[model samples]
Target: MKKSVNKTITIRDIALSCQVSPSTVSNILSGKRQVNSAAGKKVLAYAEKIGYQKIHQQRFKKAIHLILFRKHKLILCDTPVFSALVTALDNCCKAQGYALSLSYIDALTLGEKATQKTISQIISDPTTPILLLATEMSEQDFHLFENAKAPIMVIGNLLPKVPFNIIDTDNFEAGRIAVQHLIDKGHTHIGIISSSVPFDSAKKRKQGALYALQEHDFPIKAEDILYLSPFAEETSDNMTQVIQNRKEQFPTAFFAINDYLALGAMHALIQHGFSIPKDISLIGMDNMPFDCLVSPKLSTIEAPIEETARQAVLRLIALTQETEQYIMKSYMGVKLVERDSVLDLNTCK
Candidate 1:
């Protein structure tokens, strides 16, 4: 430690040795200017030999709390995807010497307080960062973020258009590819069942599906896309109607927005007297945990949840290193998983 200070060289030393102002030497350290190519290189080499570190205030605070703000809606987080994402994010946070805390926004049953806590309540400190797993942010939520002055990075499509970085999956491409795969398989009539509403991901996936149909010259009428209640009980009517209305139209293939949607549609298809693959081939997204165990395994799109989580953690960490408003974003890739649910045209009518 004494040697570090003993040999300690200041920018002043370099400026004097190089016959330049201290500011010129400082600029060289910050890499701000090209101070005469040869002369700049000399100052940089001297600085490195002396070992100088730009001491900014102490590193940003420690742990960042990840607040998942959905009080009334509980989605299972036990699957491999969710598990992997959570684990990766946790691991990244730990490795960075940061603590990760998870709190359910709705669990407090904070009601209006829940909303208030989300937007207005942020632990104030310049030391660390806050990683908000707010996959879906509404207009009100935007106002919440707008009012805060914390280091924040959201996990999904941002609502308020705040400059905090966002890390999300490419839902649109996932949807487009799922539909494109079905089209390539020689299925002309394709159907879609959207699991939820106003979910930017859900909407983008639907748009991708439409893009596939449009590209393939297939019909995509308003009735063709079904936006049903995501809850099981509320899905019965809409799923039944979709299966009934499209059966004869030979809507031989369908794309469920997610594994759960496919599962529900599978139930409805069975109740409506249709056999998987034989009567209707299906492809879903998220490749949910049980997709392969069903009567006919489901073919679906895989999401890089762990990678998504890891990226989110990394971006948030990077955000803490600066105060500039920038767009830090990343999208993981998607691939098709072939399973028993798809009917091969060579053997099927």
Candidate 2:
């Protein structure tokens, strides 16, 4: 017996089998030109039956450029969240017949003249679709890309006023859910550990936590909210100082804006001889891998990072294919991941 090689299926072969012109087959397959309904249906059915592979034309394929706009070194770094998002976007692009490219704009060190030049160079290519990773960007920083001619979408941040397609995690809802969980656990007195850097996501999470507290008729104290440095070490130091100053009074539970801050707070609590969930319950957002690896583990809100990236890529591709461009704002939902960090006061009783 001899081994046989499978033959490649082509549009020409499909057209010959269907007894139609190659141009008619090509037009029917691509949907660029209209063909007779009966002929189109027959050609499509035969093509499917024979397993005809439709190759995307090189000229029609577009590149998606992901611009990682880093205004500071705090939020957007070499972390698992960032890595997962990038990987998801790459996978989506490959599946959608588009090439993906990455660029970094570090405004922290880039001078004004150089930054403007870089922005100009990026926006110069009108053919390529752009997806901005604007996690650390401010409204002032977004003005740089406002005038671009390319089809642009923003990821990881929400700019309500700026008209562009956006895909971001629902930070506000995540914060509310975290606080509500603590409240349901009979924690009326709760504290929020927020970033001092004033990222939009952090601000929204803080607002949502505050809103949840207020809705529960809980008294909001000025000292209960603590703003720590974005760096984990600095956050730990600041938390330790806060703990020392308020030795007599501490909230039964604390909600950190992100896992980084939560871990830092956990270290400070442990150092100060406070037991997790026994003396103080805690929760955080952005369910990083370290959440599970920690001693008591961390209860957190899982940001839909992979889903956000996938949706952003799909939407960006859609925008590129559209004749009339329209702005779309999409908010991906977050999930509450229950772990060992939270203690239920209701069960204790």
Candidate 3:
């Protein structure tokens, strides 16, 4: 251990020795950054060895607790798209000198009766802000936020007329963009593969699809729209049947709510002896990493994941700092990425 008569061992000194920025060293010392786990560990060990002073006490209390709704915790953690959003949120928090912690509440395991305890545990620190996320959480469940002492901001679900702050993509607009692309390509026969569950995002996207069809004066047929359970194992076969039943009348293009559903639809289309973009063009939402790796390279609506994450953190900070009285709901824009999966009918002709 380096014995030091000096009590003022600066953050820059530690940063220089560690070959990282002073902000990074500070973030590591204050438990704000964890994305680069190895770097934090190395910095910690080095600091301890050099007898670094405890400077974290002088830092501002910028802790943020991220809680996933019990109903969709597994999906948020396990899925690549949702997991990437969570990671982006984490890194954003760290970059701004805010400590971010993930709080897990298992509603399935503990049952609905234990909700009070869950809320109590989540708001244990009154000063720390809370960021809640869920794929399909209801307003009734969101009422739990009223009891939390910390300022709250929700991600993904934006309840209409609610006072709570929200940061999410314009899913309805994204849906419109996806369908309009097919329409612009001269595809009159368009299909939508939607989730069986009544998720707001999926519902909004479907509505957007309907609006696009109406705007373009295209006939909306009931047989062209298909609903399948996102979690079901038999989706591949069901998707096949949904198209096979239509047979020669099947839509020449499809819009899926997400990449997972798009991949499923792709597999089913291929199984039914259909060539992608040759027989049918497919597009999905959420530009997940796997979208590039798949055959034909998925055409998708790319949500501003990193920007949304940064905005959420900044809004939370503004609210906590009293710079903003009410944090308004914000929607980030999305763009369609044209790829091999979508075909231009004019060119094909």
Give TM per candidate. Answer: 0.74, 0.82, 0.80
Off by over 4 Å in 1: 1-61, 71-80, 107-114, 158-160, 232-238, 241-250, 323-325, 346-349
By TM-score rank, best first, the candidates go 2, 3, 1
| Global local distance difference test of model 1 | 0.69
Tens digits of lDDT, candidate 2, 82-178: 7667667766776787756677777878877788889988888888889898989887778888878788989967878877788888889999999
Report RMSD (Å) for each prediction in the order shown: 16.7, 13.2, 7.2
Q: What is the lDDT of candidate 3?
A: 0.78
| Clash count list over all predictions | 5, 0, 0
| Clashing pairs for predicted structure model 3, backbone only | none
Write model 3 residue lDDT over 150-221, tens digit each, in one string: 788888878786568898889899999999999999899898999876777898899998899899889878
Best by TM-score: 2
RMSD of 3: 7.2
Order the candidate numbers by lDDT, best to worst.
2, 3, 1
Across 1-349, the per-residue lDDT of candidate 1 in tens digits comes to 3554544344456777887655455445544355578888888777666555332112214776666656326242334455455556656665676655555556335667665754465644455467776655554565566545567777866433556677777788889999988887788889888865456678878888989898878997666677776665657666887666765464788888877778788888888888988888889898777887888989999987767777777777777787666776566678888888988775454
Off by over 4 Å in 3: 1-61, 72-75, 232-234, 244-248
